[model samples]
Target: MEKRVHRPTAWHVTHWSSDPFSLGAYSALLPGGTPQHRTALGQVLHERLVIAGEACNAGAPAMTHGAWNDGLRAAEAALSAGARKVIVIGAGCAGLAAAQRLRAEGIDCTVLEARGRTGGRTHTVELGGVKADEGAAWLQHFAENPLAAVALQHGLACIETDFSCPLAAASDGDLPDVDAAWIALTKRLDRRLTLAEAINRYMVTLEPAHARATQFAIDANLVLEACLPVERLSVSALDEEGVGYGDRMLPGGYSELVDLLAKRLDIRLNTPVMRIDWSSTGVKVNDEVCDFCICTVPVGVLKALHFTPALPETQQQALAHLGMGKLEKVILQFDGRWWPYSRSGYLRWYDQPASWGEWLDLTDAVGKPTIAGLIAADAIERQFSGRTDEQIAMAATEALQAWAAAIRPTP
Candidate 1:
């Protein structure tokens, strides 16, 4: 590398995978699991208890809007179950959305959040003198997403983004055929296969250059989109999520929407429900009893929490089959815009141990010279193992410098 990347004045790093409240960045179905696993987890228990989240939403699992929709439906279902009072767990999108609906309906509801703040994974804090949504920032499938309109109502502007790959100058001419082969293989398969296995089996059949391209596509797109490492992702989920990118983001931060939905709702912060005891007529969340319970905690947290009398075998199996994505971020806020402003839209793909390959253009969102590198899938464990936050950030910065040197050479 000919050029050196300038040091940032400030930075932030996330460890959602290690956060006990989250236990993961989000949820993923295991290799052998199907959408039915989500259906099972979403199933209402004893007619008075329900588990809701993106993982429970089979239609759009592992998305903010999916979790939002899940909450709305969960509230309605709880009402139909003859519940007078409800206890919603987690303060994230789904729980807040559920509580919001209950508030509008004039129902008695209380939200228990383990964290001191609301917005669960949708956290936003000031960095570089601007707001940065630490967890989610995009409103994907905006045309039909309910939150898209709601964001405008909250006075949050929707910044339209280009999903088209901006990193590479030209599209791989052979890529479409390679993707088609992946689609065909996933669709025609009768058995279970991890994404890594499928990729390996398929890549072996391709020419050397095409095989390299295959890895690039997986690292550059699928892994980032899934927010999980290749080895843990299910082939079925890869097929189901298809190919989609966030077309818009809220420069004001996604937490604005969470706050809007949480308005006037009874939310108890720093309250964690370690055990949920439920029967035919009522549910006990820790020490408090409610007529109904909507457990919206992530699958990772749900797996660890205790349940009196035990959850049904089917639901237990569903929880076991569910996987969590190890999504971590390293954000660098430089004193000045030393990097190419034009390269903001151009994307880069990095392999494990390479550090900070997926650089996000936060130049517009953060209103400063900021770049966010995403570490997902198995790479997260590798990056975090025996490394401090400062060390991780430096490695990411070095990767950025290397990329800059490659793109803009110096004498």
Candidate 2:
């Protein structure tokens, strides 16, 4: 077995949770929250002010496609109400989509983005020499995802990723069974419970050995998929979300779709709208006033923006109930492929249970020597608390080397 640790040629890390414009990676429901909160946020106020984004998209919250669809819906609502001039806030997928719809219908629309760049959470950057998504990368539930059709339309190659396969470093036990146990527990719940509370209840029913394995198995997907830590996630939240086996990725990066949506649209980047003052007659976003305003900012960062007259009671409650997901990523580019090219397309390193749970191999997917490691749940807190980007890279590197040493050791 190779004892030497291989350092990366280049590395990139994401701190979505700390970004002032984002606050977190994605949207989720808190312990006492429900889908009705998302519905309430999507409701238009005064027939001239509309709010749209993934958080407002109950059918497919936390996905870019959901944001796109909601953006379109918001624009349609404003147009149907005879809106002429419009302001769409946040130049992410939702903002761009809403602007695109308005422009097509000949409604004068302008998009204001807080950052210098567009794409919101769907950022794409270089992780070595390869083009990769710094934020979202997957077209989850691809069979039903609009991104699949959009990718094909744009001539971008979409590859299916089967998550069931894993190049495990001695898995504790059948993970799916443990996953089933979680699903079963959700059904018999008599009251609202945080994920952490429910897990403790389940742990008492198992032997010490089995309990450890169960912990490893459940932790594998809990925060990694939901993006929220156990304490923040509601047990009932899973019941509202859609789960399926179909998944796909865009090798050219998700920004390609964003570009297509943003084409010919008037977007003012780096221009943050600090305050939104709206009335029954018109809407004022900062100094610019318009017939209507569509705010597509992430729910996590909404509280920072001042709204004159305050939002409706329902919107306020929804904001309080919704949560931001804590998932972060560390994409490393190596001189060569040091890890085993497993049929699973991913790895589960049980040896480094706490820090490293799952990793996606992108060598085959992106045709480069790259691997993407996830930071979620408590790992986001433990690993990123006071670490620099270099330090974060180092920590993730240590976990990666441990996996390589065990699975594809050099002779």
Candidate 3:
């Protein structure tokens, strides 16, 4: 790549894939979700109730912009008939944005949030003396993210991160020394990714029927081996979306974006909406009757909550059909760097010899002690599930030592 242009001097990285609240970073469609599910999920109920999320926008779903677009479309739908009253649940990116837009369009809207603070999965926490994004970090498709423009309008800072850096091996010590083979595998994966982008672009021009079927096929091929399949994904949802390009890091913290959106909105913290009575013209929330209601809770939470009057069997089935991805990010602050031969700022340790799973260095944060994090949702769940923090840490240290030996770099 240097042959084509000058390389940058610095970079940053993060691992939100494993956060408990997030389970996995963003929403992903599984093998069971059909177009009918997404369509049903978003279908306006008697011009009254509408669901919107990254999950709603099949094409751009699981992205910040997708959430924004969903909110806007929902608001537009609500206001089309000059509806005067509206209620929005969840104060995260989607809910807040929906309220703001509805307010702008002269529709009366209120934002309700279950957490004490807004920004559901998008959260920032203090770690090692610096504010870090504990949840969603990357601001994807910046050019289209209304939140990005909002960030700029508010003078919030943003940083760019490159995605082509080398990935480290996570295989266990006993696993055959497949570093070279793994590198080749990584290159092959990159090529396949490029191919996917081109094909997706081409998919845009095809007829809806053709495009939907093709996308389902492509998703099936791309779904991770151990994870859910893509045939369950909603093809109709991906049809109307356009490609988004700008991707950047929120230097201050992505959670701050959620906070910014939450300002001036009516939010109730720790007030998880346990049930929704949607059987009548007005929905009931914990015995309170409201003119309208919008639920932006994660599907997981929604699936667990008891619904009064019960959802339509089809809707319940749709909820049951969707799958949640599991990811875990375990951060360990070290007194100093360990690995030698630092060609790349980030390192990847894979196919671990021990039970700790894959590890990586969070080498480029703004502050101290050279923090590194390990991630392997399945492994973490298997070895550390219900185990004490000490057990998890000890397991991690052993894994790190093995990774150090793999590169054979001076401590």
lDDT of 1 by residue, 1-411 (tens): 534446778888888988989988888877677889998988888788889999998887877888999999999998888788999998888998899888888889999999999988888777768877778767878877888879877678887666554553112232233354445545544444556766677767777765555565566556766767666767666655622455687777887788787889899999988999885467889889999999999988898888877899989989887977778888788877676554335456444343454666788666787777777776766777888888888877876776665555466
lDDT of 2 by residue, 337-368 (tens): 87778775778766334676778888987778
Q: State every prediction's TM-score relative to the real structure.
A: 0.91, 0.93, 0.72
Give the candidate number with the greatest TM-score. Answer: 2
Model 2 pairs whose backbones collide? none
- Displacement of the residue 200 alpha carbon in candidate 3, Å: 25
lDDT of 3 by residue, 105-171 (tens): 7776777666677777677766555566545566777877777888888888776544334344433
TM-score, predicted candidate 3 vs. hidden true structure: 0.72
Count clashing residue pairs per candidate: 3, 0, 25
Q: What C-alpha lDDT, on a 0 to 100 scale, does residue 51 get in candidate 3? A: 74
**Model 2 spans with C-alpha error above 4 angstroms:** 170-194, 240-243, 350-353, 406-411
What does each candidate score in C-alpha RMSD? 3.1, 2.4, 9.9
Error of 1 at 16 (Å): 0.7
